[model samples]
Target: MINAKKLEEIAKQVSESLPPSVKQFAEDMEGKTKQILQSKLSQLDMVSREEFDVQTRVLMRTREKLVDLEQKVAALEASINQQQPESNE
Candidate 1:
């Protein structure tokens, strides 16, 4: 979930940009802005930093295993090719 304090800070910054005439409604504007920001942000697909990092590590490990398996297969194929010629002769 997004941080509430950070959302409030964003809302405050947005409200600060309002003209002097709208200063009387500063509280209302801030509240509404924060609500809208939260609503829209929640609707989007997002992942936290820790979750992304964990997935990255998982991918790295999987890639390493794939490379090892590929090397083993190549070595086995080479050995088979070497034996087939001697038997045919």
Candidate 2:
């Protein structure tokens, strides 16, 4: 999908006119441009849908476990308070 050389070839084959100054290298420059552009764009941080989905699933599972642990802690605290021996000096 990230092929500059193929793109430049296609551009030249599609273009009917080329300036004399660059007629000989129209294809080469176009290919080079395509590569540069693709490289730059790739360097930018971009996430795929699949990766995002996987991360989301991981987060959901973590949240569920956290909630369960919190509930257990609260129940234990309540039981401790109820059974605490009162100070009767």
Q: Which candidate is the best by lDDT?
A: 1
- Candidate 1 global lDDT: 0.93
What overall lDDT, based on C-alpha atoms, would model 2 receive against the true structure?
Answer: 0.90
| lDDT per model vs. reference | 0.93, 0.90
For model 2, name the residue pairs that clash.
none
Report model 1's TM-score to 2 decimal places: 0.62
Residue 87 shift from truth in candidate 2, angstroms: 4.0
Name the lDDT value of residue 18 in candidate 1.
Answer: 83
Span of 10 residues, lowest total lDDT, candidate 2: 14-23
User: Candidate 1 at residue 23, lDDT?
Assistant: 85
The TM-score between candidate 2 and the true structure equals 0.53
Alpha-carbon TM-score of each model against the true structure: 0.62, 0.53
